[model samples]
Target chain A: MTINAEDLHKVAHLARLSIEPEATERYTQALSSILSLVDEMQAVPTDGVQPMAHPMDATQRLRIDEVTETNQRETLQRLAPATEKGLYLVPRVVE
Target chain B: MQWEAVIGLEVHVQLATQSKIFSGSSIAFGAEPNTQANVIDLGMPGVLPVLNEKAVEMAIKFGLAVHAEIPERSVFERKNYFYPDLPKGYQTSQMAEPIVGLGYLDIPLEDGGIKRVRIHHAHLEEDAGKSLHEDFHGMTGVDLNRAGTPLLEIVSEPDMNSAREAVAYLKAIHAIVTYLGISDGNMAEGSLRCDANVSVRPKGQEKLGTRCEIKNVNSFRFVEKAINHEIQRQIELIEDGGRVIQQTRLYDPDLDETRAMRSKEEANDYRYFPCPDLLPVELDEAYIQHLKETLPELPEQKRQRFTEQLGLSAYDAGVLSSSRALAEYFDRVVELSGDAKLAANWVTGELSAQLNREGIEIEQAPVAPEQLAGLLKRLQDDTINGKAAKQVFAALWAGEGHTADEIIEAKGLKQVTDTGAIEAVIDEVLAANPAQVEQYRAAEPEKRGKMVGFFVGQVMKASKGTANPQAVNQLLAKKLEG
Candidate 1:
């Protein structure tokens, strides 16, 4: 994978970051260097090599399917930026 | 014009570990925002993530459940990105070397159809924080509470042909995850979320078309809508001689449309190198053997047992064994109820319906399995009629702790099983309806039924529905013959 100037801008935009104009070229070069290293792993020939997905060997942790939380509204509401009455308030969007 | 829709799902299941995958923070829900977050999750300087052993165990459990291969070693790579919700400005996840590989989920489609969607792989990843846009007028507030949550991103091969197939695949995966107890698989609480990778091919084509990934579809209904809408969009692009652009699109459930986030015409150079902070996770045979020993009876095996041993219908078994919790509930009810078929009926029919209607869960059900079994036994033994049984069931649902016998005694709900009492009532009805009796005895044999019904109703009224219908009908018929 190669990172061009346009690709850097798109990556930044998709990530919702405002990359400074000067930083875009710097990131493109850095990202390209990183991708080259990753591309090397592809050539290792994974023929008959199985991909690893998880580390643990355990399967199927059984839960009784019960509600474990309740009546902690006061505790949870403390994390909100703004609260009106019992509801969390945000900027209204639609009329 | 005939058209075929191709669909596949990318499910991110939050592993039900006691702590975050990388941090020591508790994975408890409904905690104060930022309270469950630790320095590692915040991605602060000088903080390093230590992988949770339980997460790896869960991933292996899932792999084993799906009959996938669990690699002896796997590596983690950094997914480079910058967002307010992403504390580290990068996500450490499995990319090239995922832990589980080459599993497939068998899905039952509509109309007795079956489709097996190949699973590409399931990788362990940490969840990012929630971005709450409502807090500010134009700014999105970031809550790191959900950040660092451990998730298993299960990606499926693009093999589905319709929305029904896609939903069925989602459901099947959901069942597997929940049954494994790796995830609660609750869409509303964000424990389980889906991203769909979809594309369309011409009626007959060897190669696949350009694919666009739809992001964070929160519900099963939304998955269906998002896939259908994306399919239409792709088909339109092809029909108009335009190409479908490969990009990440966000599904706006409120608008029922998918909007392009960005074009990924070229692949991302994530610069994904192995994390230097974390070593290659190596599992020894002894550890793997221990995890294997801890494995429970999986959903498929339980469903088979339900069918063969319990004599439950496939549909009934599927519904009961869909989640481990539901299966346990069925077992408990059977233990108490004594009749497997009746227990299956109550758990599937009444209990499930009530749970859905009341928006409660089986664990929170007011009627315990023992209580339900007791009520059913009363009905079976003719201790109470059906109507009284229903009344007792309502009392049970209301959390009345009275036993079935107590409820029956308190409400005078016992069936009038005394034949002598019922026979006396039948005689009185026969004397009162003499004309109808004569008509029944004369030329109209069919009119005899009406007379018998009249006598039975009188017996019921005299006994206040405590009289068993079978006993009443038998005594009335014998009196009519006389």
Candidate 2:
């Protein structure tokens, strides 16, 4: 499948990446070639083989159900751009 | 010209594990804003997600409870999306292979029949944080405490035909999870939530219509109302020559209307790929078997046992077995009273009515199971008739007495079953109402059937409503008829 400028713009918007109009064509071509490579990879025949989810076939490492973390609101809120009343504040998100 | 609604439900059940699914942070609700959020939950750099074993066990328990296929291996994938509440840009969720696969639940419908709702799959995922829109000036406050909390997203096949069926399906799921003790199943506290996919088609159409998903309906009542509103909206849209558009809609409970939250085109593609950080979850046969053996008697089995073995009606069984606490309470009542029918009635009728009026759960009832059983026992042994039993129940609810016998003794509410006392009252009633007695004797037997009730009432009134009604009827029949 070929990626168009409009599709690229939609993706960029969804990722919250503001792409300049002049750079749209270049990014589209680059991303489209990457997608084409993926298309070519998908075209390879591998009928009976199971799809690989991870690099190695292994089970998940289990952890005991315990509360090991303490309150770190002050420590974590130090990185926020804006905070008030122990909350990370952002521009209002309606819906 | 007839439109039929097709409905399916996706339920998000928050697991009751102590910590978040991927992090060791506390998953307890109502913690101060960011207190429960750790570095892992806040998506700090270099932090990896370690799976919680209890969460996986809970998910397996649910799969076993539903008799679903537990895959030998399940993989977690990153569902890419962007929102302020999601600290990480992508959420770790199972997509291609979920833990529970291809199960069905038999939900008891109102018409004394069970409707089997087919399950598509149930996957485990993490919840996003809350975006509090209030109490901030032009800014949203984010509480990351809920972030990384484990959630089991149960998807159902589009088998429901009405709002009633959808609600039944939700209730059944709620009962199952709560019974398993995996989740508290409290909708108001956001432990359990539902999203409904609804569409409409012509009455006999085999092909499905365009469906709109109503998202995050928290309450069962709201779910029913939202589906009804959406069905009406879709039918009207189709009837007016406007095609239904597939989109995500939000149910506005206040307005009782579903509004478009986002169109299909604006929705995210959610580029899903297996998470490299976490390994595939492989379950051995022994582990799955252990979970199956450890599973509790589920709602359907309990309901069937109540109906068939205990001889309770289907409705009573359904009501009693709707929640684990209620079923346990009913069982304790039956065990103590040794009367299954009476226990069923008292639990479903009097106790339920009191609980509803007080707006409390069965666990918070002022009257304990033994207390209720005591009252029921009084009713059974003719110690108190139904009316006196109700009075004793009211007294128990008001904290007037600890046991049924206490209230019965204190309020003089026990039935007077002594033949001599009843005969004296009957004689007084007969002598006081000479004209009525003469009329009863002169009246035909057919008319006397209706007339005899007056004497029974008078007898009961003379005895201050403590006389046994059947004994009163028998005595009145012997005296007035002969």
Candidate 3:
């Protein structure tokens, strides 16, 4: 249940987060402790216990289908870094 | 060595709900960018998402139509990914537990047989925004209008063997979704799309080859082409001593080839976990049973009824019932005209041809069902011949007149069934063509039977194509003999 520095670096890369090279060891130690806690939690025997998604014991609330939003392109575009022609502009992304 | 392609499809159809899946934003197409996007869709802070009821109902309807199991409780999970179109940086989808499960669809194969494709499961998810690749000052433009639109992702097992079966299976999905009225099924509008998983293995091999998933196959034809190309690529690679690598590929319709996606081809890990914002959706049996009861007649049942009750040929029935709009059009025409056979012929023949020519859907056809039935009524009562009916149909399509009777009166296209009028034209034809008449008399009786066609044409021509063909035949025979 130990996470090495390389594993932490890979995890950061996948999450698109940048961490300093010197900070990798500290983050790895922190992640390893978190994993050990998970290992401890999994050690408990709970056979036949149904896994639950939420502790509230409630269901999702439903909304009737309706158009409750209006044209707020100008207002929303003001929050973005860049915009043109009512579109949110971002760095070039291709798939 | 013969290699067989094993194909599976993950079809994503947009539910025709008024609002978004988890937001109250409008899901209308072709809207101005960001206009339909609300706070919830924009992933704004302090905003919570509530499930739209109509989306759940649509999922249930599709599940029942496909004979899928409706799990009383279904959970939504967050699929962690990074993309500009996804403002939330994670898409809320279903993972270990989906709403609909274990369905089977009976897709008709090209070899005149049915193949039962096992449905792995179908899940509901929110769509991402559109990333306009057009140059925006060396950047990409994002439109959030479609961000929260509801999509039902139907996943199938690896049961299809060839491109033909793949297309047939996709078509079956299209028909069922349209029939259930859950999706608009407009591929061009991005309402219906699919991702194809393709692999090729040696013949009789039990183990599967490494599969590559081809994304962005937006059309049915492209699905077939992409899968075939991927299959060929894998088989050729194996033959050349290269191992096939599992990856995600993009289908380039312009080049008709599948290329590996640029950045994420090495590996993709979407760490999925239950979404904390949305709770599990619990459905009762009563709601599911109500949907099953009120479900519209699906394509299979309609096709069967058309053949068994309406006495339509299987081919004709299939053509009519291929789409909901076309089938309902045929049904209304049959009801109004009271002739299923004739209605099937017109709907599958002339109307289909015209719609294809105009590149218009049946819902947008210029001539309504009542208008077509009115024209067929004139045809039924001998008010107009088949040729004249076409003329009336054209005129009606061109908005020349309202009804068939009006067009017949205006264009003088009524059939002349009266024996007296036909006989007069027959006399004139025989007198004007004396040289031919003499030759007809000198000819043998057996040869004379074919010779009468010339006189029939002349009589009908002299009557301006108004002479009834059967009456023209009889009168020409008697006068030529006498």
Best by lDDT: 2
**DockQ of every candidate:** 0.09, 0.81, 0.78
TM-score of chain B of each: 0.88, 0.96, 0.92
B1-482: candidate 2 lDDT, tens digit per residue: 99899999999999999999999999987888899999889888899999999999999999888878999999999998878898888899999989999999999988878999999899999999989999698999999999999999999999999999999999999999999999999899999999999999999999999999998688989999999999999999999999998889999999999999855555558989999999999899999898888888899999999999999989889988999999999999899999999888888888898889888999999899999988988888889888888888899999998999999999898899999999999998898999999999999889999999899888877877899999999989999975
Off by over 4 Å in 2: A1-4, B438-445
Winner on DockQ (1 vs 2)? 2
Q: Candidate 3 residues A1-95, lDDT tens each?
A: 99887788778887898999898888989889999999999999989997788778999989999988888888878889999889999999876
**lDDT for model 2, on a 0 to 1 scale?**
0.92
Expressed as tens digits, the lDDT of each residue in B368-392 for candidate 3 is 9999999999999998888888889
The candidate with the higher TM-score, 1 or 2, is 2
Q: B212-304 in candidate 1: lDDT tens per residue?
A: 899979888999999999999999988888998778899998899999986544337566766666767776778777877888887778778
Shift in Å, residue A28, candidate 2: 4.0
Q: Is candidate 1 or candidate 3 better by lDDT?
A: 3
In candidate 3, which residue ranges exceed 4 Å CA deviation?
B108-113, B236-243, B263-267, B439-452
- In order of appearance, the predictions have TM-scores of 0.79, 0.95, 0.92
Highest TM-score among the candidates is held by which one?
2
